[model samples]
Target: MWPQEVLALSRRWLLVTLRERLNLLFSVLQPAVWLVFFAGAMGGAVDSRVVGTGDYIAFAVPGVIAFTVVGNGVTAAMPLLFDKETGYLDKLLSMPIRRSSLIVSRFVFQTVMNAAQVLVILLVALALGVRPASGAAGMLVILVATGLLTLALTAAAMALACAVPSHGTFFAITGFASLPLLFMSNAFVPLSAMPGWMEAVARVNPLTHAIEAMRLLVLHGWSGGVPASLGVLVLAASLLLVLGSWQFARQTAERIA
Candidate 1:
């Protein structure tokens, strides 16, 4: 019953998102724009010693994909926050369905949506001459790492949405966090290129770990770093999922009480 409810709710959210065609278009286009323009503009100026590749686009493909994942995952709270504003969340709390299903379904929906968007980004990268060095197997590993990161981020976002009182507050917090998180990571530049302080921060940034894992798979194929990077992401996903689930359960229990 719980599984069935989660599936149905996830399907409903997927359909709702698909119907918002412009939203979907902009979501894809935002990252695509960064991939093409940002990578193009910065590619020539960057030293090969810093990026470890003459082709910045190839190097940036993973970074831009990570950007897309983080953007989508962190902003995954908007819909639920909007529902709160609309009184829909209160209504949901009163439903016959398991309360846990509401949170799980959102996670499912965002994961699916993020994966689709990432696929389109990969296709665009391919058309632009960015080939994965690790082949199909490497691509699979990239997506797996990406999905783990998504789970961790979406869990955190959803927990924030529930805790915050308004969507505007949520927007402000997420918007403020996104750029710092991106710039601090090896998203556009490698850690070797960063200053000592920034490099220390990037080393601890989950986005950096996730990007490095995917970047390794995309550019270098199999490597020792891939497993370590994936390990970091797995730990992040597991910890955040547990914490987020607790937040959801507590919130729902209070609402019902």
Candidate 2:
């Protein structure tokens, strides 16, 4: 079926990804820097009374991981866009593979890669004294929640890469997006301290849910913001991805002509 074709395409993408050493390194370093310098700079000041991590650092591990996966996922479709502009995608379409299969495969591969990157970040968090709040069960739940969120966001990002006109615009959008959202989310501080409006915004941010979910798994165990925030993340990512996919299909179809 198409799913099998998608998986096969993902395998091929992995091989191609291995050739892009700079992208791989930069992607790994970017998130690590955020967790180390940006996070450690705060010292012991980050709070998690509401978000779940005992302190800011622990609370941040998930957010940092989410940031990594998100950065990678949204940019995953960039190469395809470049290929299209350069005539590579046209040649690809001429191959034996089904047209939609190529797109689906790329999305699947990026989702898996994003998940892998987050795992590495999680390992680093363990080394940094950020142990899970609950036992194995909590860790599993957190993993599932994070994976779903990451996968959905990655799809949306890839969709943007497909629909956006140029690599310049894609990178610009990513830069503009990463910082403001991170700051606005509950990654660094509890929403409690913010003005009522900002607090409300943070409460609704998908990133906030991702952070809250991680906080529960790592710091507070089962009693954290598991239910509420996780729900928001899923719902929001789903909506965005649907919109992105629609846009991507429209653009790709135009290009195919």
Best by TM-score: 1
Estimate, for each residue in 1-257, the C-alpha lDDT of model 2 and write its tens digit: 77877888788888887899898777766676688777888756644455444456676777777767666666676777788779887787777767778777776777677666666676677778777778668767777776767657666777777767788888888778877777787666767767898888887778778877877777777863687777777888778777767776777677667
Q: List pairs with backbone clashes in candidate 2.
A: 46-56, 133-218
What local lDDT score does residue 125 receive in model 2, on the 0 to 100 scale?
A: 70
Evaluate residue 75 in candidate 2 and report its C-alpha lDDT on the 0 to 100 scale: 69
What residue pairs clash in candidate 1, if any at all? Answer: none
Please report, in order, the local distance difference test score of every candidate based on alpha carbons: 0.86, 0.73
What does each candidate score in C-alpha RMSD? Answer: 1.3, 2.8
Provide the TM-score for each candidate, comma-separated. Answer: 0.95, 0.85
Please report how far candidate 2 places residue 169 from its true position, in Å.
Answer: 1.9
Candidate topping lDDT: 1
